[model samples]
Target chain A: MSIEVNNIHRIKPIASYIVVKVLEETKTTSRGILLPNSKESPQKGEIISVGPGKKSESGQLKEIDLKQGQVVVFGEYAGTLIAQDESSKYLLIKEEDVYGTYE
Target chain B: MSIEVNNIHRIKPIASYIVVKVLEETKTTSRGILLPNSKESPQKGEIISVGPGKKSESGQLKEIDLKQGQVVVFGEYAGTLIAQDESSKYLLIKEEDVYGTYE
Candidate 1:
């Protein structure tokens, strides 16, 4: 299942945590029939929400480098699985767990 | 083997990393023989060195709360094993891996 990048989310993460919606891949047959791959979840996703930042030892807030709506790739087993609804699954992960951004 | 807290270390860590010397327990037999327990390595250790701190996304350097000569406890499989010399083994780990400090 996937969510629109512009959709509003009710959950807010704290301290460098990010809310991500996992992107699912859709395959197509020669006849243009769509086949949903349910065996595995992709590591790529869109950032739905971002935290303010992690506090330094000196009590300074360091802002995260990422912004909402950006697509990013994370580690295979990086985040905790969370469900926003019965059909929508989100991932809560640290900004450091993001491997890179997709252009 | 354990190292003296006052001894100076030649290696320095970078980016919120910490260098720790694992403490070894020594037992005595009824006949007054000193026996070194070599079966398992303790998770407790003395902080030999610490990094400045992890850089914030804004490029600010935070200070670590720990200092040299302080005893700290880490996870059972938290750090990477490194050797300063033939008899001295040290663990290189992130500051976050430290569970607590011994007062």
Candidate 2:
């Protein structure tokens, strides 16, 4: 694993949780208007690390399907935001909180 | 199933989604301070209906452990709120968005 990947695991998310690095969104819209950072919009991020799945009714571990490096879309305010560093932040979201994945 | 249960099925939630009826929280705290409806706090709700689980990486449908009538705790602003009727409303959340279930 690279240094960036290793840094993500410093804080391990538990129980079907995933750590994602929010990707930088496009600053300009199709109309060439620059979107402000304060704009409210759905977010996309790349999975950095994932926890073991939550237990099922029968005590089996239900696996999360998302893999590391996969980009996923989530609602505008779905998960808890954690500041990993002055220059970066990460989101802690359950696997199912992800609405969809980018192909 | 009772009529209420049947009524909940009118809208079938899909893909690990669940329909939850927000419960009436305690109006007064243990110290007897009245809590206003506008006060923000984590929410608790009973599962009205649950959709089939999301698909796994292997293409199999994963299973959700929550059952009908089960009360679950969720974040303060976790899911989309849907009005079911004039006096009733429901929330649509993915199974993993549920933090815990009351036994």
Best by TM-score: 2
lDDT digits (tens) for residues B1-103 of candidate 1: 1122233264456557777888754446578786565644337889978866777655667888999999998776666543333344466667888889877
Model 1's CAPRI class? incorrect
**lDDT tens digits by residue: candidate 2, A32-96:** 44434342344667888888778766566777767888876566677887655656768888876
DockQ of each: 0.03, 0.03
For model 2, the docking class works out as incorrect
Residue range B1-103, candidate 2, lDDT tens digits: 0112224445456568787998867758889987775866678898988877776544468888989999999877776543333345466677878889987
lDDT of 1 by residue, A1-103 (tens): 4444334476788998999887643333233433233222225678989998888777778877778998765544678876656556688889777644544
DockQ, candidate 1, comes to: 0.03
Tell me the lDDT of model 1 at A27.
Answer: 33
lDDT of each: 0.66, 0.67
Q: After superposition, how far is residue A47 of candidate 2 from its true place, in Å?
A: 0.5
